[model samples]
Target: MTKYFRSNVDAMASYIPGEQPQHGTQIVKLNSNENPYPPSPAALAVLKNIDGEWLRRYPEPFGGEFRQAASKVLGVPSDWIVVGNGSDELLGLIVRACVEPGKKVVYPMPTYVLYRTLAEMQAAEIVEIPYSEDYSLPLEELVAVDGSVTFIASPNSPSGHLVTTNELRKLASQLSGVLVIDEAYIDFTEENALVLVEEYENVIIIRTLSKGYSLAGLRLGFGVANPKLLQGLFKVKDSYNIDAIACAIGTAAITDQVYKNACVAKIKASRNQLATDLKQLGFHVWDSQTNFLLVHPPQKKAEYLYQKLKEGGILIRYFKQPGLDDKLRISVGTDEQNQTLVKALSSLL
Candidate 1:
């Protein structure tokens, strides 16, 4: 594999995503944090009404339509946005633009593991600081590294905790390099770091429609920052990164905020109820600000339960790594789906 590739490419492991079992009515998927609800009617309408001829031509180079729609929703100017195939692609773009071989990329762990994979792809040195006891931002520790870029996934995955806005602002002020705030799950949380964009020129906030808007298949995500900071991204991004279909559907979906909000409200309610049920079963569940719960099962049966659930046509995330080997991440599913998961776990107990 490495004979024709860079030495670093041969040494890195690819990022493993949650499983998507395509053919099973019996399967209740709670592994990936996908919106259990459907996409906005307005977006579906756009998908239905797209003129075939429009796609025959090249798409607008920078996702003009989506930028304007998200701008209106976010109350920011359109130029301040940079759209990506997914927030994942935008994350890669930032890494490519900022990190050189042997440069440092920092974040608190355990986090979105993609950051580590992205750094490995670039042969960049990675600095992973442990989260504070309460999962607050390790501000002083992060600032000391002075890395080329820092990535913070708010309402962090597998932990479901968010860094305080004030702490992020302070870190942004203290850092000598870029601060990328990954807000993929922010819709489920009470607060966010969007305001930091206007406050600090060095900050970039990444978001996705995959979680709250129910548009994961569309692969649409965007980054928010001061326009000055977006120049390098523009220079490195593919000429036609966003397609006409995504632009149209994304515009309709983002513009239909009422529909998106209703769905988010349901997921949040379910998250609360699910946490309560798991606690009753003796699992140590974290207070989540996202559409999932990070639970440590009683009797150290986390791994065993994960296997038994899968055999019962249920799927949840199980990480076999240090610090998280004993935990499971359960995505908030519909009430019926969650009941199936709980029953399976209970039967194993």
Candidate 2:
């Protein structure tokens, strides 16, 4: 019975999300990088309106309305958009499409962590290019990986440092592979790589409604790339990846630019204040262009701090991986939530 599983399945290394503890009412959850705010009024309205028909009929296989909404909002054509349950689904699809048995997939170390896990699931050779001490994208070294597929998370995860346009352009020009850019945190940043897809056929950018639009639980995301690349993906995707209720909520969220901008602005402000305060407390707080911060804690060890925070009804993420062993990733919560986290940290330190 133990030998029945495929070798790839048995050896598979899974992606670990931050803890979701349900025991406390006053808990401040700064883990999982989720938008601390709830979904927009428009999204809530759509959710409220849903009923029997939505539950009865199958949704459009391609997330047609969501695509159209994203197209109008992103200023890209609908043909360039492909919606998924979350950007994770789109990532898994890309892995299935581009990775053949022996082909390789390369991404920076200390990245989203899922890229390596997804590559392994495809049985693709995994190439890990370490980031610099400053956590910048090592494009010069990354391009050297002998792989046909390269996945990069812009304003990358855990550390939230974005790759510059110049660095990305250099990779596009030099690499012959499909360069998949995960922009899950792009809303918090001033720069984006969406325009690059027009100039480079190989650039695929994945986005989510989770962070920017505040619809994580709805599971709405899209991958934008050239039509040719999306066509290849269509063959491997599940028929109705986007459900009816999600499609409705996602469309409303993407179209409501005013609401989205306000939320992003608030989160950015919170992130900056948190970073400054953490630095003042003698922690090496990384400057983030996203909604979270990767901080080196003061006084107590990371594991100890994590436990103390947990006891105080606050949850932040701690990674057991090498290089990140001493760091904790904290998401920007609401104003009061942010204040509570700082206070808890202060008392503990």
Candidate 3:
């Protein structure tokens, strides 16, 4: 730790993101919950057509182009949207804007680990409410905390289970502070709590193009909230957080509804099939609305399977945390890649 660094910054642990292997095209990667499909054709077309002169000037400070596109598609006003470099950036912005030192930031544990890191960075009090034994939301416990900011991930990471809208509405109504719903994987599910924003002034729902839109490489995310709440977020955000090319491509991707829907449909189908296949192999697989399966392997330990699969040129996510040690989170890949994973597991087990 540096002598000049703030004590909070020196003491806090950084968030660890999913690994992006450097190996070229040989490994079947199911580690990150990235879309296995390509991005919309329209987005690619926009990227190819971007002029060099446009790159010379600074991009729009608020990502107007992408905001307009998102508004048109999501049925929200432009002023209600705030774009970010990624959802992670927006998450940090929320913590900075709402949570003060000695104030509380609450989130469910065994969810996104970043929530804890974000709270720690701000020197805020952390209230981590553990999920139920089956990995469902502990709604009553969360509401009682009444933090300065509360984060909830629907179709949560690693587990892939969803919390219902009524449940979230109940929690929101009871809380005194901001309720930020991180809907990064909501595209894969049937329910979205977007309407809650209209009903509750304290509610903010954030979405990312990284999952269903297959634009992880572009790093675009946006939040929809009451216009007044969005104005507060705008103050905390970087002056030019999103670049010109990202705005152009994000606009194109949002406008291409047909292509995006097709890709999501294929992924949903694959997710269902993958779960069924793993269950048939004697693994206890949870029902997932997201593009991943959390499975408990029948014979070998979860860590053993994780390492063995890595050696066999297939990669999946296995968290070393307490509750998650027994399960492996596998992103739903293309049929060929998934089949190869199953074959590898079958051979090893």
RMSD in angstroms, all models?
1.1, 1.3, 1.2
Task: Give lDDT tens digits, candidate 2, residues 151-229.
Answer: 8889899888999877888898888889998999999999998889999999999999889888877888899999998
Residue-by-residue lDDT tens digits, candidate 3, 40-69: 999999998999977899999999999999
* Per-model CA lDDT versus the true structure: 0.93, 0.88, 0.91
Candidates ranked, most accurate by lDDT first: 1, 3, 2
Clashing pairs in 2: none
Extract clashing residue pairs from model 3: none
TM-score of each: 0.98, 0.97, 0.98
Task: Estimate, for each residue in 142-164, the C-alpha lDDT of model 1 and write its tens digit.
Answer: 99997999999998998999888
Pitting candidate 1 against candidate 2, the one with the higher lDDT is 1
Residue 207 alpha-carbon offset, candidate 1, angstroms: 0.3
Top-lDDT structure, candidate number: 1
Tell me the lDDT of model 3 at 26. 86
| Candidate 1 ranges beyond 4 A from true positions | 23-25
True lDDT of residue 343, candidate 3 = 91
